[model samples]
Target: IQQKEHPKFKRKGDDLFVEHTLSITEALCGFQFILTHLDNRQLLVKSQPGEVVKPDSFKAINDEGMPMYQRPIMRGKLYIHFTVDFPDSLSLDQSKALEAVLPPKMTAQISEMELD
Candidate 1:
């Protein structure tokens, strides 16, 4: 039987793939959102407290995909592909604040030129 195309999900061998976009703040901080399944069920999706989701990262949900063929009770995996959106520019104060909270910047060393 041919499966109908879902607006937010792509099916591949019973597995479901969905792309989710997040802001820079949400990528660094934690985030929570609801996802609607094929059966019109709402799923609460969230990141761990210390979990930092990078760009193009994937999160898999067990048994949340399309039902297995023949075995109606069993299901595949639901994968969420995440993409982070960054701001166009940051002010000097914002940069300094981020620098203070984030890791220290690496300094490049310059060697003195020898006299010709």
Candidate 2:
């Protein structure tokens, strides 16, 4: 974490000015998705793993068995960062499966995994 000093402000006269400066440090954590457009395009579709996928890859099936091949823009390194609020019941095999899909260099940091 890095500490940054920012100026505090107060509005008094017509001219706005900083009354004082305060130092603060903020901590932020979240998942990051790095996707590459399969078609070599700049547009990227980002979402968490197991989240609602884009409309293209999956098709809504009706009782009549109507199949629609909605090609979603696929391609890119999807990085998912898990927080402390993440579930603790995940198994090692499941985690390994996810790591396999990632690029050779990309790896997930699993902080805790204990078998009973």
Listed per model in order, the count of residue pairs whose N, CA or C atoms clash below 3 Å is 0, 5
Give Cα distance to truth, residue 32, candidate 1, Å: 0.3
For candidate 2, the lDDT comes to: 0.30
| Ten-residue region with minimum lDDT total, candidate 2 | 19-28
Candidate 1, 29-105: lDDT as tens digits: 99999998888899999999989999999999999988898998999999999999999999999999999999898
Q: How many steric overlaps does candidate 1 have?
A: 0
User: lDDT (0-100) at residue 33 of candidate 2?
Assistant: 34
Q: Which residue pairs of candidate 2 clash?
A: 31-81, 36-76, 56-70, 56-72, 57-72
Give lDDT: candidate 2, residue 94: 74
lDDT of 2 by residue, 1-116 (tens): 34244243222222222211111110111123332322243432333444533212322212212112352232222222222233456599977875686557746666556432
lDDT of each: 0.93, 0.30
